[model samples]
Target: MAIRITGTGSYIPSNIEKNEDFNQHEFLNEDGSTINHHNEVIIEKFKAITGIGERRYVENNLNTSDIAFYAAQNAIENAKINQEDLDYIIVGHNYGDVKHNTEQSDTVPSIASRVKHLLGIKNPKCVAYDILFGCPGWIEGVIQANAFIKSGIAKKCLVIGAETLSRVVDKHDRDSMIYSDGAGAVIVEESTEEGGIIAHESATYALDEAHFIYFGKTNHPEITDQRRYIKMYGRKIYEFALNNVPAAMKSCLDKSGYDISDLKKILIHQANEKMDEAIVQRFYKLYKMKMPEDIMPMTINKLGNSSVATVPTLYDLILKGELEGHIINKSDVIMFASVGAGMNINAIIYKY
Candidate 1:
C-alpha cells in the first residue's frame, strides 16, 4: 500500500495587482522613516530580487474559506471521489479569514470545518482541522495525511493550503508587494500504486529565529491604531533558509533512497526567486553536481508568495499542464520543499 496523491487542484485569483500598481504609494522603513528611493527604483529592485511582476488578490466578496472550498471542489471532482467517503479534511493556513478592508481575522469556526460545510460533506466521520505551519502547510498537510493512512486511521484525505496574505499585509511596507491570495488542494489516499510519497522531513528553529517572520505593526509607525500586519526580517529568513533548507531536502531524498540524479523536479515555495535558486544550487552542491536546468518549476513571477499555497499551487499547475515546460510523468521522482514563519522548514520526496 502507498499514500498516493490521486488528484490536485488550485484556485488562482483573477484580480491581478501589477508591480507598477504601487508606484504612487509612499514606501516606508520599519522606523516610520520614508524610503529615500523613488517608487520606480524600489519596485524595480523588488522585482529583480523576487522576480514577481504581478500577484493576485481575492475579490472583496470572497474569503479564504471560499477559495479553499473552490480548490477542494476541484480536487474532489478530479479525484472522482464521493464526498461522503472522505475520512478527513485538513487545511493548512496562517491567518484565518481576513475580510476585505478589515483588520480582524475570523476563525471561530475553523477553515477546514467551513470548507467541509461548503463541500457539502455530511459524514460525521469526516474529521476536519487546520494547521499553522507557515508556508510549508500544504506539504505538511500531505505528510499528516500520509501518516493517517499509514496508521490505519484514514482511507482518503483532502489536504488544502489556502491564504489571503493581501488582507494581512502592511501596504506601506515594501514586502507587502510579495503577498498574494490563493489556495491549492490534493486528494491523498491509500492505493496500490508504484509511485507515491516516499519520505519527508520537518523542523522548527524557534530558539533564536522565533520571530524571523511575524505579525506586527505596519512600517508606518505614525498610525497609532492597534492594527498589526504581516512582517518579516527578509535577510534573516533568507540566511536561515539558505543555511538549513538544502540540508533538509538532502536528508529527505537520502531517506527515500533516491540518488540526486533521480530528482526530476523540485516544487519549492515561491518565497523569493534568488533565494530559491540559491537553495537549489546548494542542494545540488551537496551531491557534487550542478543543478539541472528546468529541474525546478516556479510560479512566483505571477503568483507572488501565498504563504501555504505556493508549493501545492505550483504542483497543481504543472500536473495540469498549465505551467509551460513543466510536466510530471508516471514514476517520476520529485521533491516539494518550503520555509517560512516559525522559521520552519520541510521537504517531501515523492515518486511520481
Candidate 2:
C-alpha cells in the first residue's frame, strides 16, 4: 500500500505588505538607533531579482498554530474525514507560536499540540509533533507520514506547514522583504492505489552554513516584547540553494527509478524566483534536457518564501488548479524540494 495525499488546503493572511510600501524607517539598531539605507533601490532590486511583489502577514493577535488550525480544518473538510479520524498531526515550522504583538516565540506546548487542541480533536490515540527542518519541513513531515503508513504504524496523518515570518522579520532589513505569513496542509493516508509517494531524498551541509539563517537580537532594546528576529547571509543561501537543490531533486527522481521526462511538475520552495529557475534548469541539464518553464510552477512572486509553508501551499494551489500556468492531473508525477536554515535540503517524487 502507498501513502497518498487525500486532501490539501492553504490559508494566506489578508494583510498585504508591498515592497514599495516599506521605508527605511522600519529598520533600527539594537540600541534604538536608525540604520540608514535606501529603501527604493532595495525594493526595486528585490523585486527584480526575487520576482516578489508582496507578501502576506497575520495580525498582531494571531500565532503560527492558529493559521495551522485553519489550514488543517480545510484539509480535513476537503478529505471528507472527521478530525478525530486523524492518527497524527505533524507540523513543520521554524518557530512555534509567536507571542501576541511580537516576533518572539513560545514553544511550551509545541505548535502541533496547540493546533490539535484548537481544532477540538478529542482522540487520545492521535499523536502530534513538530518537525524542524527549515524550509524542507512540510515535505519532511509528509515523508515521515509515508513511513508510518507503510510500516502499518498509522492509518491517517495531517501534515501542516505554517509560518508567521513577519513576526521574526526585521522591518529594516532588506532581506526581510522575502519573509511572509501563511499556512498549508495535507491529509496523508493509506491507499492500495498504484501511485502515491514513490521515492524521496534528503541531505545536510551544516558546515559553517547553519548560521546562514539564524536567530539574533532585535533592534529594539527597551521594548517589552522579545527582541529576536531572523537574520541571514542572503548571497550565501542563494548560492548554496542553486548549487545543491538541483542535485537533490535529481537524486530523488533517479532513486525513484524515474526520468525527467516522466515528471509532470516540479513544485519548489519559493525562496528566490531566479534561484528556483536556475535550480530547475540545472536539474534538467543533469538529464541532458532543457527545462520547460511551465514545468516548474512558481508562487514566490506573490507569496514570498514562507519557509515550511512554501511546498505544501504551492502544492495545494497546483493540486486545486488555482494557477494559470500550473495544473496537475491524477497519476501525474511531481517532484518537491526545498533548502533553508541548517543547510538542510530534501526532495520527494510523488504520483499525484
Task: Give the best candidate by lDDT.
Answer: 1
Model 1 sits at a Cα RMSD from the real structure of: 0.6
What TM-score, computed on C-alpha atoms, does each candidate reach? 0.99, 0.94
Candidate 1 per-residue lDDT, tens place, 84-127, comes to: 99999999999999999888999979999999999888899999
Candidate 1 lDDT score relative to the true structure = 0.94
- In model 1, which regions exceed 4 Å deviation? none
Evaluated against the true structure, the overall lDDT of model 2 is 0.87
- By summed lDDT, which 10 consecutive residues of candidate 2 come out lowest? 23-32
State the C-alpha lDDT per candidate. 0.94, 0.87
- Window of ten residues with lowest summed lDDT in model 1: 215-224
| lDDT score at residue 249, model 2, on the 0-100 scale | 91
